[model samples]
Target: MFFEGFSLVTQDVQGVRYRFRSGGTAPDAIFLLHGRPETHVMWHRVGPLLARYYTVICPDLHPERSPEQQVNDLLTLATITGHDKFVIVGQDYGAHLGYLTAATAPDRVQALVLMEALPAATHEGRDDMAFSLAQYNSCWFAQLHPKPESHTIPVPAEWLEKPLPAESVFAPEAVADYLSASIWQHARTVTWAAACHPIRCPVLVLWAASGRIGGWYDPVRRWCDVTSAPTEGHAINGLHFLAEEAPGDVETAISLFLEHCIPE
Candidate 1:
């Protein structure tokens, strides 16, 4: 089973159980965090692709835990894996939390790969961007769901038919997993509310040019401006999950970046 390496492990922290994919050699761990409404399953395809070279760990951001608690769980997981520092790859809500975890613990994060990540400030610094999908006539689920209590719009399979700009980057399985997981978890927008200060690590921001969330170029640019970490941004042709949509391109970028950070 490709999923046999995947397991649901429970952590004492907050009684939360997260999914992890265990494979690869020692010294380097590639942790994958899924966005809202999704779980470790979101990276089923991409994880194995990277797992061939590095240990890939994907954890479900169970809506039950707060952002702080989530990071703590990540740290505990890292400790359990015997890794003091590791690289992190995240998408959408996952990217948002990745920034927080990296910023809070620079020593623990060797490198960061963020896809369709939200600027920490965007959650509060700008209110005009928080319009509803009805008002904005766009997919503004994160903004609309300001709190955990807000309702989540179910993203059905039909939505994929009208592929967004970056659809080519991911395979059908990746998209299906994201859609199903997000729909199952009613509190899919909580991570959007998470914000952070500057971080001090190598950072890569991969934004989906066709993203329906706040695809504001300026906001994306500001993330590079505010981060103390050495940062670079690339506008890709995919939707939110660039890794799944364009695994080859993403793998190339990730491998090159990790080479400089992890060292052969």
Candidate 2:
């Protein structure tokens, strides 16, 4: 089993049943959120490693909830688990949710780890021909409001119309979970204005060195603009899926960041 000793749990919050995995014995907690086209399984590799030092919570994000509702779910999850202060680590769409969660409850979020995503303000403010052309597919996907369950129905490969990394890069079970539960809701981008309250907790931003993020903008600098607390950024050697392609690097970067921010 990928999760090994992790306990599989399902809890109801706000009339929604949330399925998640919990492991490790530490009092301090860390929540790992997955991006689009994936599930909590994306963190299979990194979660066990982090579990050695912290309680790790990996949850399958509900498909059709507003950003505020999603944040509420996470905050409530922490409360239910008896964690007043915890760290958040999110990727892609998950990064967006993490930002909202941190902003919604700054007192409870001790720190944040965001990968392969920029703050909404940074993205909107910097939108241009180059970015639009490069991210045309993503932009198109954002406009689509497909049925929440549309993702589960596999379409022809040609329908994707975009190149994806080889399947070998991901764990087989993880891929299976993604295929079964991935939803279009992940494509919906949350628009958080730059004028909104800045996140006060420390942040660690990680992006794919070979991906479009570095080529499109100064990720670290842009993140610094949105955070009032200390901000650090790193470029991992991989494409958009940092955790899947470079789990070791991801684990190392997060471990080092958490060590400095939440000392044992």
Cα miss at 93, model 1 (Å)? Answer: 0.8
- Give the TM-score of each candidate: 0.76, 0.86
Q: What's model 2's lDDT at 148?
A: 32
lDDT of each: 0.68, 0.83
Candidate 2: stretches off by over 4 Å: 136-167, 185-189
Highest TM-score: give the candidate number: 2
Writing each residue's lDDT as its tens digit, candidate 2 over 37-82 gives 7889888888998899899999988747778888899999999998
Query: In candidate 1, what are the lDDT values of residues 1-264, reduced to their tens digit?
Result: 344455556555446555555666755888988765466776766776677778877776765666677788898888987888899888877887788888778888889988775575654555364443433224444444564234434443344674643435444655565666543454534535434555778887777667744464454466766676678767766766565566677777787778787766
Pairs with backbone N, CA or C atoms under 3 Å apart (clashes), candidate 2? none
Minimum summed lDDT over a 10-residue window in model 1 is located at 129-138
Report lDDT (Cα) of residue 8, candidate 2: 87
Off by over 4 Å in 1: 1-14, 122-152, 159-197, 212-215, 218-220
